[model samples]
Target: MRIAFPSTEKLGLDSPVYAHFGSAPYFVIVDADGGDVETVENKDLHHLHGNCQPLRALGGISVDAVVVGGIGRGALTKLNQEGIVAYRAVEGSVSENLALIKNDGLPRFNIDQTCQGHGRNGECIH
Candidate 1:
């Protein structure tokens, strides 16, 4: 399965996961079966609060799922419509999250769980 993780830097699997999907600058795409990895820049990083475009941020590369610290309802809906599941990421690097995915440890983000606002430290205030 191909999994995408939103990251703040281009550290590959060691990259720290960004707090918000739409605002992340890079993405670490991991191929679980083949053990291949790819990093891509977010094409659509700047937008209004409710206008995040998941496909555009991913550079149109198809993936089975996305791992993020937070995501808005609109972006989550868009990803779901494209058959991509969004999982709530733990507070760690992409490598940690990848391991969690293998064990089905991450929780799928329901619409209500989506980010409604940002916290004082920039975490999801949902």
Candidate 2:
């Protein structure tokens, strides 16, 4: 499966996972079966409240799922509509989150569990 992780930097598998999906600077795409990895800049990183377009930010890169610390309800819904699943990520690097996924430790993201706001006040609900 092709998994995408919101990353703070382009450090490949060692990159720290960013807290907010919409504001993350980079996305680390990993091929689970092939062990291949690539980094892509979030083009639509900046946006007004309730206007996060994650798919556009992804630049059309095909991904089976996303592992993130937090995500907004709209973004989560959009991802679901597009057939991409989102999983709540643990507090760690991309590799650590991957381990959690392999162990079935991460929970599938739901609209009810999405972040309440844009995380501007440092209150991420995820």
Task: Give me the candidate number with maximum TM-score.
Answer: 1
lDDT tens digits, residues 1-126, model 1?
999999989999999988899889899999988999999999898877788888998988999999999999999999999999999999999999999989999999999899998778767778
RMSD list, candidates in order = 1.1, 1.5
Off by over 4 Å in 1: none
Error of 2 at 41 (Å): 0.2
TM-score of each: 0.95, 0.93
Q: Which stretches of candidate 2 lie over 4 Å from their true place?
A: 119-126
Count: clashes, candidate 2: 0
lDDT (CA) for every model shown? 0.92, 0.89
